[model samples]
Structure formats: structure tokens, C-alpha cells
Target: MNDGRRKVLKAGVAVAATLGIPFVARAQSKPVKFAALLPLTGPFAFAGNAALEAFRDATEYVNEVKGGIGGRKLELLVEDTGYDVAKGTAAFSRIVSRESPDELLFVYGDSTGLSKALAPEVARLGLPYSATSFSSELADPKTYPTIFVLGPTYSDMMAGLLGEVRRRKRAAKIALVYSNSEFGKDPIPFAKAQAEKLGMQIVAEEVTPLSMPDATALALKLKQAGPDFVIMQGYVLTVEPLLVRAAKEQGLNATFMGTYYSAELALMQRGGPATNGFVVTYHNAYWYDSLIPAVEKIKQFRASKGRSISYKTTYYMGSWFVVDVLGEAFSRAAKAGKLTRAGVVESLNNMGDYNADGLIRSMKFVNHRLPYIKLYRANVQDGRFDAITDWITVG
Candidate 1:
């Protein structure tokens, strides 16, 4: 074996020793395969890279430290989709067809569009699937029997923000600003319904491209509408900051909040002063929240790679939770003597509250979605989000 392979095998042996398992026995066992699709070279590349690292670390932990799922080494097959639906679909097809069906127990999708596009194929393959998206459409257990979301849907997140608005300001005037993509437009109808249910006035609804080079017009529009709160949804990293800054410059007297994609340290850093007092919802703990064992593991893993822990983000935490959930399902399947894709789906369906090592609260799947959501305010000074409230269960 090459020097690198030799070292890795030695480390695996050491890990096996710690688990009280013989290396020879583990070497004889086969591997459980997982296929991952990531947006590595596209608009979401930064977030995708962070998630990729988290998956790598989680796979290492499962194989080396945890002695793999049921004594079979965890093998991960990853491909870059560049955030394109067609590319993602092609990648999924290639992976499923190329890999052994029995060995490939689970698949991870990169985007909401991809998840929805491949739902039929996933069901046809009879494999349990997870994704980076939390689209409400994917949460229907009847429609997507094997699909699982890591947290609340976009609609639930919007509802959480609206509930917060109503709690803080009675009969508040709210506006919904979103991008023009599947991700951005996913929760607009639900959010509007929620506003109506809360008796909040829907003042302005604006749609912009994912990359809003000049948000001055939108800012002016929002300024004129003068809503008490403006909820930004379906943006990954750019539009929200520009809108928040432009709106602030335009003297828009509204509290700005965002859905999950806008809740990141990168946003705070990019928006600087404008992001001050900005609130966003998150389904996973931040990197600075090292109180959790999983977070600590991420820290150590990054340190081992000669990188700072600060490089990790909320996206990384989310992806780690994805893999951890898969590990849990695999374990349960093994226990049931049904370690195939269908078995994993059955295990996921029967799962109760799972906290992913306290990175989030005890998550119970309601219609294949976790109903936990938490609010965080941007601390521009530190470029991090501070919890504004405890975990709120969304209906």
C-alpha cells in the first residue's frame, strides 16, 4: 500500500482498538455506500464546500471511530452538480446505476428542485433519500415516502418568523420579498396565508432575481410600502444583504428577517453594519455553539486538517446532521435485519425524536419533516448569530 493508504489503515486500526473490535474482523466486512450530490462549483459553492467537509468528517467518524454501521465500513460517493437541476438529475442517475443497489443504502440530494425532480426515481429505486432542502412539497409523507428533510420546511420557517412578528408587534404590517427561483418562491403562498391568519397586513410583495445587482428600486418600493417587517426568503448569500443595506439607506423603517439560507456568518460579514439587528431562522446550531458534542467533533476534525474551526458554518452543521440521521437509520435497519434501502426508509418512518448530538433539539418527524425552528439575531461585531429564542415547534 502507498504511504497515505497505510497511514489511514493504521488510524482505522487504532480506532477499531478503541471500539474493542479487531481490525482483522472489520477488514473482512463489506461497506455500506452513500451517494451525495453537492453544488461544489456553482452559486452555492461556498456553502456546498462547507457541507462537503462536514460529510467527509461524519463519514470518517462513522467508519473509524464508531466502527462503521453494523461493522460495515461507510463508503461515500460524492459528485458535484453545480446547483443545476439537470446536472443533479444526471449525477443521481449515474450514481444509482453505477453502484450496487444493495450496497447503496441512501442518497443525499443538493437542492429542492433536484429532490422534487428525482422523487419518482427515488421511490422507484426504493432507497431512503435526504437533501439540503427543506421544501414543504418534499415533506408530504404520502407523496415522498422515502424522502426526509433535516428540519422544518420553508413554510414552517416563514410561519415561525411571522409568529415572532405578531408576538412582538400586534397587527403588524408585513411584506414578503423573495427571489424568482424554486427555492425562493417555495413559501410565498404559505407565508401570505400565515400573515392573513395572524391578521397582519400584507403591504408589499416583491420578486427579484437571485442576483440583484441594483436593489435600489426594490428598496424604494419597500420604503414606500413601509411595512413593519420585511421577510426575505429563498436567497443563498447575496440578495438579502444588498436589499437590507439598500433599504436601510433608503430609510425603510422595517425590521428585516430571513429564512434559513440567509442565516449565515458570511451574510453578516458581507452586509457589515446593515446586517445589525437583522434576524434569521436556523434549524441547526452555529459553529460557535461548541457545547454540542457534534460541534466539538467538527472542531477537532478541522483542527486535524490544519484548518481553523471558524471555517465551519451553519450549513456545515446542517449537513452533519444529515449524515448523522442517515447513520441512525442505518443502525436501526441493521438491528431489524433489513439493511437495504427499503429498510432504511422503514427505520426513518418509525424514528422518534433524534437530536443529532444536541446540535439541535429533539427532532420528531412530522410528515417527513422536523418541526423545530429557532430564531437568531446577527451580531455584526462578531460576525455570528446569537439565539433570540429557544426552539419553537412549528405547526
Candidate 2:
């Protein structure tokens, strides 16, 4: 075997010894199932695959180092949704039907549309569910008691970004460029309201497909509008690079910023020189933040797969965060002698100041969402985004 695989096997052996269990017996226990609906074949395939890899690494860590949740290994069940709401919902239904709800510890939805579509059903079934979406609607604990959001809502991130813009450039004229989807349009209304409240002018609002044939038209439109800043939403990797390149080529001199989904390493690598000075809002620290012990651990695990963690995208970090949060909830529920769906929800509700091993700031849930946000600027020379501001909490 390769050296990395040998190291991982050695680590597993050490963990089994520490737990006072034979390695074979430890591997034989029933597993806690986690079902994930991912868009592995469509526009967001890159992000889905990254998230799946992170999930796999985290599950392996849990089963090895952590001895699993309450002594049970984690078995991940992933289905490809192709970034379609209908396909995602159907996949979720099929998975849940096949797996016992008790065995299935939690469910993860890959898109905002999928999350919204599955919310009612998840609530009806009283199954604990989380999603990659940052939609404000999912933060409603009263409406969807069993659902959890891993980070700030899109509206909150927009508000935080606008707050930063106002701080740097008072009364800035801003344009909103987003994808034509539920994910893209989720925060527009709230953003408009917040912009009005903050005295920032809404210069232009443009919509483009998630995968644009060309961003020339939109870039020219933004140039004509003459906004001081442009905020991009509803994209993982594709549209941002094209839009930024087209805008720069058209001589559009506006500062570009993006929400969580658009703030990814892949964007910088793809956009190249155009990504210089690009700013983004995010809740978690990037994989390069080795100061975070969890990030270091992730790097080691990723190396076992013959990959570098620095190439990981924001979706990858978000997926690992979800796994960490779920592991914490499972531990808490097991301690309370109630390792069930209701118990997990209660544990999640009671959690406070969790930082996911320093990958994020001390996060607290308010209205079922963490209200923290941070700003980062792409350092093109280093090909990484460096934080420009500390955690900013939105009200």
C-alpha cells in the first residue's frame, strides 16, 4: 500500500486500541446512516463532488478516530440530483423509504430549491434535516422545527456585505447580479430592503443563467449602470469567472463581491488574473487556515486520498462543518440517553458558541441560523482568499 494509506491504517489501529476494542469488531458494528442528495451530474457537479469527498473524509474520521457516534459507524448514502429540484426531492423520498428513519440519523439537501421542497416532508416525518442552502426561510424554526442551517442566510450575508461596503465606501451605488434560480433570487428582496435602509443606491439588478454562454452582455450592462460595487449570487464556480473576465475586458471598474456559494478557490483558479481584488463573504475559514486545528486535520485526511486540501472549495468546508455539527449533536443526544431525531433537534437547539474546531468563529444560533459573517479578498499572487475583516454579526 501507499505510505498515506499505511499511515491512515496505522491511525485506525491506534484508535481501536485506545477504545479497547478489536479493530475487526469495531468495524462490524451497525452504522448510523446519513442520506445526502447532491447535484453530482449537472451545473453544480463540481461543488457536489467536492462536498461528497469532504463528507467521506469526515465520516472516515468519525468511524476511525472518534469511534463513531455512540459506538456506531457512519454509513453515507448519496444520490445525484443533477441540480434539479424534482430529482432532488424524488431522490430524498426514495432514500428515506428504503432506509429506516431510526437508522438514518440525518438528511442533507444539496440546493435551496431541494431544501425548500423537502422541508414540509421532513417536518411531517420529524426527521432532522440540514441543507447547503442559506435561504432565510429555512431559518424559521417554527415552520420547520427539524431543519437546521449551517451558516448565515443569504439575506444575512448580503446585509453584512452591504454593511461592509457602506463602511468602506459611504452611500455606494451597488448592482446585484445573480443566477436565475431559487438560490440566486433568495436574498434579492431582503437585500433591496437592507440597501434602502443603509442608504446604498440600487444601481442595477441583472439575472443570468447559472452556466452562462457568455457574460459580455451582462458585463456591458453593469458598465452602463456604473455601479461602485457588484454583488454576485447563486453560483458555485462557472458564472463568476465568466462575468468577472467579461467585465474586466469591457473596462468595467467596479469592485466585485459574492455570497457564500460564489466564494470558492475554484473561482479564483478559473478566473485567474480577473479574480484579483475580488471580495467575498463567508462564515467559515478556508482550508488554508492552518491555524484552525480542524483544517489541519482535514489536510491530513485529504492527503490520504492523494489530494491537497487547499484545492478544496467552500462547499467542501461547509460539508465538513455539517458533519462536525451533526457529530456534536449525536454525542450530546447519546449522553442524554435519547439518541433519536427529537433528541438531536433538542441538542442542536441547545448548542451555543460552537466553532467546529476553530474553522469558524464562535457561532450561536438565533432564529435557527448563525448570524456571523466575514469578508475576504482574493490574493491572486497566492491564489487564495485572505480575510479582510473579522466576524461581523448581522442583526
Best by TM-score: 1
- Tens digits of per-residue lDDT, candidate 1, 61-113, equal 77777778888888888999999999999999999989988899999998889
Q: How does each model score on TM-score?
A: 0.91, 0.89
For candidate 2, what is the TM-score?
A: 0.89
336, model 1: CA deviation in Å?
Answer: 2.1
Q: How well is each residue in 1-395 modelled by candidate 2, as lDDT tens digits?
A: 69999999999999878787655575446677888888899777888998898888888888787888888777889999998999998899899899977778799998888899899999999899988898998989999999888888999999888988898898999999998999999999999998989899999999888797889999999999999999998887789999999999999999999999778777878898998989989888687787888888888877776876555777888899888888888878878987788988898888885788976675568888888889999888998888999888886
Which sections of candidate 2 miss by over 4 Å?
1-29, 302-310
In candidate 1, stretches whose alpha carbon ends up further than 4 angstroms from where it belongs are 1-28, 304-307
Query: What CA RMSD would you report for each candidate?
Result: 8.8, 10.3
